[model samples]
Target: MDKKTENFLGIDVGGTHVKIGLVDTKGQILQFAKEITASLRENPLGFNLAFVEVVGKYLAKFPEVQHVGIGLPGLVSKDRTTTLEIPAISELNGFDLKSALLEKYPNTIFHLENDASAAAVGELHFGTGQTSQDYLFITLGTGIGSALILDGEVFKGVRGNAMEMGHMLSRGNSRLEPLIGRNGILKIAARMMDTFPEEVGQLAGQELGMHVLVGAASAGNSIALKTFAEVGEILGEAIVSTVRILDVNEIYFGGGISAALPYIMPSLDKTVHQYLSPYYLSDIKMQRATLENDAGTLGAAALCFMD
Candidate 1:
């Protein structure tokens, strides 16, 4: 058997569904499946048990796989053996997930990590063009997610879960997520449309969403442009603080909402350059991440490469 072609399992645990992929060392997904988590969440046996049971089913089906990587959405123990807190699935809090999986599959090696951090690892390994081993990764989606890569590894702070930029306090002491996340951006768009009805263009009398906002922005709608500008300013302010603390120059943005980056760039760049000094601004590199929808699955598999 070709050891290099050995299959590995990647599991991305989310609130609504769990995405599973059979990936090889080169990052190609050979097989994929998704399990809606509503039933698992409602199961009387509890989410932890239901989750384990589902994974076992996959393991039984892919008996040749001995390595499994699970990417979780919230906080995890520094030792990476237990889930400290998972907001989407509260039952996982303080659960010794590693032990549970081990009890069921004694011969397999299991790896766990924060989902955002896992994405960063995937980018480091699979991204194009001399991807930085050290960079700040930000995912703009339903919520803002962040991770720091230092010396080719996820930078876990003293407490384990580090680089949580979303929770950072921003304007008026509001959390960063509420100020610039998906909902936050939509709120800005609505307010802009309301403020400048004549400039609303395609957004006039329409249901607002990220896609609509991006589409309008692409079509040069004044309201859409204004909304993204505001979001960029707020997000850029947060990045300024993050860059100052972490001292990382290469920044990569990903996720569904990052599509608005072009619209947000004017204010984002202005805010970043306005506050940062010459030394910090000189080498700064910020751009969109290459991996898109596949990032989560690829990231889960990337966990197996971590020490």
Candidate 2:
């Protein structure tokens, strides 16, 4: 490696696994590793020890590394000293993580943030997001993760937990996470499969309600169209709401389930067009999130150079 390419380590700690990488300023990932473990994601002590073991092994090969950054599924406090509150990851509540990590490894600087926010910055630095002044990233996984960028900077809300669009109420019934998030799609599909029995929702994995709805749109299925209409309407309403509040024009989306975009976009656009003030929707553009799983790691890595 070139002397200038001395890299930073970016680690994405998700609910199911941890992804580690060595990334340089040029957006190249030189090495990557992933570990699957449930204990690592829940227990703060377990997570910390796992992190130290995994990261320490990787960094040992490159002795000169100066910085390390972590992207957690829940909220990373604004002060960078603690992992704040978030649903699902109940164990991390009020953990003063920065102090713990610093005490363990006194020689290196550490940066922490929510996984979606980290991915947003990663996209901003190395992906299509690099060109936009304002962009939002929504990752449709087991749950929903969202991030916002304004004036070319990642927008970390007051509590370091902003842009959580997934938890936003959709039908006044339950949160959006269960409706459109990765597992949410499966739940909808399973319910449809169980209730209706013969509908397309019976399809597996990414082939759930959203994909089925899109497939219906492609084949001119009215009922399928209605399904997307409902989801899109909800998403559109949310996007329009976001636009009014943030005035961001370009939004990028990606995740395991974004593959359903074929089904979701039409309704999403329709909802945005029908309900939002014409002024707001006129210039807004919706594009697929570019980096997928890589965004989080790269975004976490960006912390090494960003500030």
Predicted candidate 2, C-alpha RMSD:
3.7
lDDT of each: 0.89, 0.72
Off by over 4 Å in 1: 1-3
Q: Clash totals for all models, in order?
A: 0, 2
Q: Write one digit per residue (lDDT tens) for candidate 2, span 159-237.
A: 6568988877777768887776655554554555466555544243444444464565577554454555556666777
Question: What TM-score fits each model?
Answer: 0.97, 0.84
Q: Pick the candidate with the highest lDDT.
A: 1
**Candidate 2 residue runs with Cα over 4 Å from true position:** 1-4, 39-45, 86-89, 190-229
Model 2, CA-based lDDT: 0.72
Q: lDDT, candidate 2, residue 10? A: 89
